[model samples]
Target: MSDTLGAAVIGLGMMGERHAQLWAELPRTRLVAVYDIVPERAQAVADAHGCLAASSLDEALAADGVDIVSVCTDDQSHLQPCLAAADAGKHVLVEKPLAITTADCDAIIAACERADVKLMTGHVCRFDPRYVACHDAVAAGEVGDVVQVFARRNNILASGLRIGPRTSVAYFLGVHEIDLICWITGARVTRVHAEGTSKALASIGADDSILSLIRLEGDAVGCIETCWIIPEGSANSLDARLEVVGTEGRVAARVGGEPFEAASASRSSRPDIVYWTEVHGRVAGALRDQLEHFADCVLDDTEPIVTPAQARHAVQVAEAIHHSLDTGAPVDL
Candidate 1:
């Protein structure tokens, strides 16, 4: 192992591409290989990054100098690649909600544990400065005796059309808030009652929106609103916010309401500046910070910021949400 860790990324979707690019761009890691279900996609990314286009997951993990693997596959398909990466003795960084099911999350976590390698689930919001600042304030006792939390993560109609069929909006978007609420408040979700409605994505047999009322371990309550039916013409593709109210004070963080905007004759847009954005020809923002954090953790042999257990908790809550939606009753964890 040199000073820099070598990286491999499986899956070549939008998020996967970003992972590959960041691995190539970051100082502590360099892209060594990339693999995708589609050979052409893998080849394209490898060509652009000057890395190996692995023909299979085995090849990607076996590539010379590959020390870390980024499992950027879809919500449901995370288990296999993650297990393979761990078995190959490489560190793993997977995208959230970790997996659509708690069982899969556990399998991945166990595999990494057995292999004695680090595992991190990419709950990118934790790396966001605003979210981090909010968490810090809460931890510092600025928010005394948290009583309630409210989170909203709404995306454009295009997102629903693109991802609704593959997975529900709750796992795709709601999990971020689920994890954040528990992390910021330092309480586990004890119960969840959820309801969903579908119209725009009904044709695809997917819910257009889901609202969940959650009770934390200390009787703290939370409301989570996740919808993917916002019009694409909206200035931002994503609109998200989180607020924590306590007996002494309240802390809140807002996303998608960025001050910077660009307008042409046809439309105006607010590009994401916090999550994944280009600055001076390189990837910058929370996602980059997240990747760097994982690399540094692996290099230093320290625990990742987003532990496997914490990530699994988010998946467990998501499963409970779906169960509540199915039974039309509250599901106690």
Candidate 2:
């Protein structure tokens, strides 16, 4: 076998393009194939990465030498291709929420386990330095027995217009915090209470914001607040914050700071200072780091930092939260 791993990307949207570029650039990974429901999009990515534009997902999965598949499809459409990849004996790196339903997530997990293939969810927040460092602090006992947490991911209204129609705020925006809070505290969410409203995005029939009160094992309670109704003219694309209060101390983090700010006649805004930033003409920061880690783990035959089971649990929690939103009551997990 070659030292480099052969990879295929399914889905040619923004994230598919990113994954294609990362596969081509990673030290020991080769971008070998690309696929999408749209032929032109697949061909565009294939041409850019110097790979084949597979006629179908099966062709991509069965491409000679391809050992890894990156599933970048929409949140609700992740299960089928994942199962196909597992059947092809290919390792999978699926973009989060994993799936819209816990049963689908469970099927993906079980298929991968039976196929003896590794599966990792793309919960990029867990890989970000801001959140990763905080998680480490909590795990290191610096925060000493986390008792409470609060996390928020408020995006500009543009996101509400673009994404809210396809997925809920709970799965699309709240999943990050759901996964991160659990990862940091190493606890299972045992119950959830949530409320939501859709007036701001009524035209699209989508929820504008949601708040979830999640209770975890060991009695550690957390809040997940997600809103996609930030005005288009807001200073930043996102308003995100995470805080964990422990018995002995607390850790807080926010993605902010950059020397760049634009104050125009009509509006004002600030450039993002972290996560994925273009530097010296290429993508860098936590996005690249996470892809690097994925490729490295594949090459070294090691377990991923984010496992299928853990990702499944995150989906379970997100589903419960959605149920709570619907029933206007608490859900016990």
Candidate 3:
């Protein structure tokens, strides 16, 4: 067995809690501490896991024997904690949509490089069993030379409970599909055109849904549709579909099944049936596997599967989509 690495998780939200749980269970990791702006939440997780709850970022960084830090905070909040962890000489795993902007991601990468720390972004879908299988099939030329792709991720508003209106669907929902598309095809996005609407979530000051079309450098075309306006009680769904048209043949799979059902009520509202559990839970195994991989990289002195630079490119693509929507024109990357 590898030596246990003491780890700290910042941000005790749903993702943070999940990371703590996984760290507790992973034989190579020990959850030494947890930190959250909300002291109570951090304390709760620490207590449950027999660890400490650092009251501040400095305390967490200064804690003795912490070798790894996991940043599970909001997109905007990732920069500082990540920098501090790197400066403290700890390997860092940051949750994805690296940051709200490319500049922020660059800064985090610079900090990690300066500190000589291993930095891995949380593009956990690459570790997912289904996504892994799909990637393998594509690698074996099951799809031949890829030609076109389509992917979608949708969920009820319940999953949005912690996410505020300020968060865009492109960043929160679209980033996953964006990363997956690029990973599956091994091509760079060259141009993007997007449109978004906020009929139900206008009050939240964010477009609740988005549709995007992207042109890849290799002439492969892709589309992504994401939303969070489904009713509260409706099943939370993460619908992902990928179709790879190659010169010789084609391969495809739906990440989750779509089920149709009817509900009768006086008001008679029809809700879309949700197909996935919590978005995080649907990908929990992936998250755990990714963390283990990060640990292995640290132990073996190997590069991470998802580098900060690649993560920055994903952010760039997402930003391009946002720009495309705002300008009503295709944005070239």
Candidate 4:
């Protein structure tokens, strides 16, 4: 095998395109093939990147030089591509919220395990410097005995309008915090009491906002706020914050309020510079770091930082949150 791995992206949406671009740009990986439900979309991406525009999932997996598959399908459509990738003997790097349900998550995990291939979910928050620093501080005892955690991730109305019709806000946004808080505190969420409102996305059968009160394994508690109904005039497309309060001290990270702001006649904006951004004519940031990490792990034959079980834990917690919302009562895991 060559030192550089070849990658295939299975979805051509925003995230999938980013993955394809990064694989082409990254040092240890090369974009070899791409596939989307729309052949024209796949062709456009392939033409831009000089890769094959596969007509089907099997063709994409079988494309010459392909070693890894990046699954960036919709929130509810991750299982089939993941299973197919494993069957083709390729490593997988899937986007977060591994699946909408725990059973689907298990099936994907089992398939990869059976094929003896690497599997890593794309929990990009884990790769964010802000969250990484906070996790490190808590792990270093700077925050001593965590008592509680609070996380908020809100996006502009455009996001709600674009994604609400397809997926719930909890799975789309809250799952990031669900996985992040558990990772930072090193505890499992034991129970959850969740409530949701549906003013903005009610017509689409999606919630505008979801708030979850979570109890962890060690009795530490957390509050998670996820909404995508912020007005477009807001300074940033994303508004997120995470704070961990401990017996001795506290640590927190804030987004949407970056100092780098650009103002225009109509509105002032703070464009995203952390997740994925064009820098020096190429995509760079946490998302790039994440893809690089997955490629490196596959090349070195090592386990990924974001393990399948850890990803499944997030789904389990999400399921509990939905259950709580349905029952209008606290649910125990």
Candidate 5:
């Protein structure tokens, strides 16, 4: 690879466009090619970034001078593009929920290992400033031995469609808190008790709300509440609250309206949502930071921040949550 890494972005949706924009501006990366199932989307992004728009994944994979690939496609379609990148001897940075299933995640991990390629998942919360500050505070014992945690993610109907009806709230929003709780406390989830209900948007076959309680390895417990019941034309939003009650004292971080205000409102307003402010601005910055970190890891042969094994654990927890909902019983990990 040259001093500037030649990067290709697969999938030109919201996430993909962010990646493309970041690569265009990143000093260490160059946008060589972009591939999307939708040609117009691909061309629009590519033209804006001054990059080639590949007609197919194979073309993107075979494009000359490409050394890194960002797999920004949907959750279910992550495997093939990642495997192709690994086979093509390119480093890969895949978006989160590594895959829809554990088996598929395993295959991608195995292929990357066998091919000696670096693979990093897009658990961007690990890089978020607020989350980073909270993690540091907890690690420094500012929160003492975290005994309990409460987290929530809620949004309006428009934002809910991003995850789609086929996927559960646990995988889409809960996964971030799962990773956060684990990362902050440095513990593995031992068991999960969960329940879900859908009073709205029944057309998508998705739960309108979900609540889960997780027991960690050290007996510390965490709770997650996720809902997609915010009405249409409402502000797009993601509200999260983290309260860590420890042996000494408690520390909490919140990113939404106050409880009283939230209670008064029918649903969260858009003012709370902060992920995609300038379309490609924040997310693109995070994606660039993540991919650059992965590139450094590949160059230095170091372990990635979020390893495949960790991603697998996230998926396992998600599965456990789903199982708990189905069996109406706490599922042991």
Candidate 6:
């Protein structure tokens, strides 16, 4: 067995809690400390995982045993914690849209490189079974000369109310599909034209939704649509799907379905059929797989499957989309 790496979680939001849980659960990992701006949240997470609640980011990075840090902070708050961890010589697994801007992404990359530590962005959709299969099929040329791609990720207002204040729908929901389209097609986005509407979320300082028309350096064209204004009556939190078309064939998948469903007078919902689920009474799925990949890369000294450069490019594309939204013109990338 590989030596277990000690881990620290730097945030205690919903996603941060998941990271702490998995860090403790992984066979070659140990949760050593937790940190959050809110001490109570940090303490609660630390208590749940039997680890220390660090008083600050520095304390967490300097913890006696932590060799890995998971930066699960808000979209705009990822860079500082990442830089601290890298400077402290800890491998980092930062949640996606690594930063709100391209310059910040570049800075994190350079800092980690200088410190000689592995830096990973949490674009976990690439690790999802459905997306993984799509990538494999494309690699095998099953799709044969990719021609077009259509992807959609929409969600109910409940999630938007929480997330939209921190980042736009494009970065919050569109970044995953943006990364996936580029990952599978093996093409960089050369130009982008995007339009966003602010019907429901305008008052919150972000668009309710966005649609981007993307031009790849290669021949394939893409349209990625993301909206978070779905009604409360919706059956699921997300209405997500991905479809890729080519000369010889096409592949498509609906992102969320239910292995179980339930209803009450208040509302109805469908639990995830895949991604993250309790398998035999424990957390397991692509989220775990993504973390495992990061752990393995750190333990074995393998290159990350998702490079920092690619993660930076996704941020660039997201920025370009927002620029387009502002100017009503497509920005060449």
lDDT of 3 at 33: 88
Q: lDDT (0-100) at residue 45 of candidate 2? A: 93
Q: List the candidates' TM-scores in order.
A: 0.99, 0.96, 0.90, 0.99, 0.90, 0.97
Q: What's the count of clashing pairs in each model shown?
A: 0, 0, 1, 0, 1, 0
TM-score of predicted structure 6: 0.97
Candidate 3 lDDT tens digits, 1-333? 248888899998878998888888777888888999999998899998899889998888778778999999987788999988998889999998888899999998999999999999898778766676777888888877788888887766755544645578788878888888888888878999999887777666777788999988679898888887766555324556767777767766665444544456633333322311234433245677888899888878899988777888889999998899889999999
Candidate 4 per-residue C-alpha lDDT over 1-333 given as tens digits, one digit per residue, 9 for 90 to 100:
699999999999999999999999999999999999999999999999999999999999999999999999999999999999999999999998899999999999999999999999999999899999999999999988999999999999999999999888888998899999999999989999999999988788889999999999878999999999999999998999999999989999998777889998999998889899899999999999999999999999888999899999999999999999999999999
lDDT of 2 by residue, 1-333 (tens): 579999999998978888888888877888999999999999999888789999999999988999999999989889999999999999899988888888998899999999998889999887788888998898899988889999999998988888988998888888888998889888989999998898989999898999999899999998999999988877888888999999999999986435578788988778785667778867787778878788888888898899887888888988898889889999999
- Candidate 1, position 180, lDDT: 93
Identify the runs in model 4 with alpha carbons over 4 angstroms from their true place: none
For residues 186-281, what per-residue lDDT tens digits would candidate 5 score against the true structure?
888999999999767667778888899999988898898888777664433556777778887776777655332333345544353333334445
Compared with the true structure, model 5 gives a TM-score of 0.90
Runs of candidate 5 exceeding 4 Å displacement: 232-236, 256-285
- For every candidate, C-alpha RMSD to the true structure in Å: 0.7, 1.4, 4.1, 0.7, 3.7, 1.3
Instruction: Summarize candidate 1's per-residue lDDT along 275-315 as a digit string, tens digits.
Output: 98899999999999999999999998889988888999999
Model 6 Cα shift for residue 290 (angstroms): 0.6
